[model samples]
Target: MSDVRQLLTSLQFADSAFPSGFYTMSHGLEGYRQARLVSADGVQQLLADLLLHSVGPGDATALAAAHRAAADGDIELVQEVDQRLFASKLNAEMRTASVRSGHQLIDLGAELIDQGLLAEYGERVRLRSTPGCQPVAAAVVYAANGVATRQAVASDLFAFSASFVGAALRLRLTDHRQAQAILLQTSPVMEQVTEAALERNLTDLGGFAPMADVMSAQHERAEARLFAS
Candidate 1:
């Protein structure tokens, strides 16, 4: 059996009901799908590319940073990564998605988490002094709650993919069974990416996912959009 603290960390971060606003944010996949860039027939590859080219190294680094910052009560790390989030997510839509989800996570944490750091971060972001990107906020949540750096990053990655899968499900890109099949097919890929993410050094955190950036930029001006990002 897992230790009490480990089980608590997993239970807290892994729960989809933690109010990360994950259900609403698509993380650029919605835009790509609507643009027909990610066809229903090719969702597996799309998911793979997203994990590899985007969240695997990019958000994982931020997540790791957040985890450590939370551990040491270093607010500067959170703020630095927030700036990185803006620099890395070139598109307005993607940036908006991150902040929105992060704000929601902090809000939910106030009720669920024993720590008050996330709640304070949410207030700062709402006041426009800080950028409340999801990766950073999620790291705080997991780290404060005793989740390991590796586990916290994994939670972020899983949550990222799960949100896109939810978006695909809502868009009718695939039925439940098909989505599950895609997730299963992608499960191994998630593990591999997590491994790569674990091996990654802290300094190598930036990424440029061009297609995702373009899609998000277009989505910002997309006249009839369903999801936020």
Candidate 2:
């Protein structure tokens, strides 16, 4: 791909533009803020923690697995990825959020592109046969559209990390400059995270961020909320 085309693809999948419903998710940011366990620095650290332990190795890994499955035309493997993602995500709110967003993306993609495998799987998920996570669906679509699996996974990482940053923005936990600085700092290292994840097998994917899971669980029951999980 030309440099310009690559830049546009990157921008299209960017958190600010990608409409995978990430804007609606705070991923426990609400609970953490409510519990006073997060401030500006805490926001940065939480973003860091989420990126390193949760998203980078977890959802991003799931995306890579989905991409590989799609590339091989292995829908069964993709189904396994979906089931594993569904089961490993302990928090009810988090699981619901993932599947709900995935459903939206699938419905939208089916109408907009009709990209064979994508259209089929989107319908599959809609029919309650294949429960996919949004990141996985997005990665599969990206892979089918000629983007490399690694780049697709990398884009997924940035998208996942920025959701927290976006949440921090809305919660007043961090300002725009801090968010930009954090994203910029993580830019170079994103590849390392993506590569390690893409190199893994889907079924064995596992990550433990108990505090994050707990906070997400707590956010589900918060009397008031800014974002959905």
Candidate 3:
């Protein structure tokens, strides 16, 4: 019964309609589209690359670390993880998008979960003591709600993939059917990434996708943009 409840909780948080502000960002797909770098056929590959080399090593790892820290009732360690993740982001746009969504998630987690830790963390975010990256905020919420560490990491990874594929749909790079296929095909990669993130040390947090960073930097200078990052 506890396992079932944890599954449901993970689903609720991972849902696209949860108002995490993920819809406002493209996860950097639009910038690639603008540069003519990706297409319908390449969408899955791009997502896989990101999971393997970027999001897995970076955000997902941070989520795993923060989740464990929160589970241990170590808010200071959680904040340290959050600060490290924020500093790892190379571009201002990526950092801004993360903090913007993070703030929203932390606020929602505080009200919805009604956990004192979340409330305390939210206050810290307000005071700018921590950047409140989305994954870390999610970590606190999931930990407080009894979601296991691995499940928490995997759920957030799926949410990120969904948001990425959703962005691909809006960019007209993929149809609805292809988008679903892309997500289905990426499951194995997600699983592998999740495992890696779970085992990753906080000192190793951050991704090395220089090209993605470059694309994001380019997107920042564009006169017109569809997604925030």
- Against the true structure, whose lDDT is highest? 3
CA RMSD per model (angstroms): 2.3, 1.7, 0.8
- The local distance difference test score of model 3 is 0.93
Runs with alpha carbons beyond 4 Å of true place in candidate 2: 1-7
Give candidate 3 regions above 4 Å deviation.
none
Residue pairs clashing in model 3 are none
What's the C-alpha lDDT at position 76 in model 1? 69
Worst 10 residues of 2 by lDDT: 2-11
> Each model's TM-score, in the order given?
0.89, 0.93, 0.98
Give the 10-residue window scoring lowest on summed lDDT in candidate 1: 1-10
C-alpha lDDT of residue 143 in model 1: 69
- Across 79-185, the per-residue lDDT of candidate 2 in tens digits comes to 77877887788889988899888877776666656577887687778788877787778766776666777778887778877887888899888798989987877
Query: lDDT by residue for model 3 over 1-229, one digit each (tens)?
Result: 2999999999999998989999999999999999999988999999999999999999999999999999888889999999999999999999999999999988877777677778888889999999999999989989999999999999999999999999999999999999999999999999999999999889999999999999999999998999999
Q: What TM-score does prediction 1 earn?
A: 0.89
Question: Candidate 2 vs candidate 3: which has greater lDDT?
Answer: 3
Which of candidates 1 and 2 reaches a greater TM-score?
Answer: 2
- Model 1: lDDT of residue 205: 78
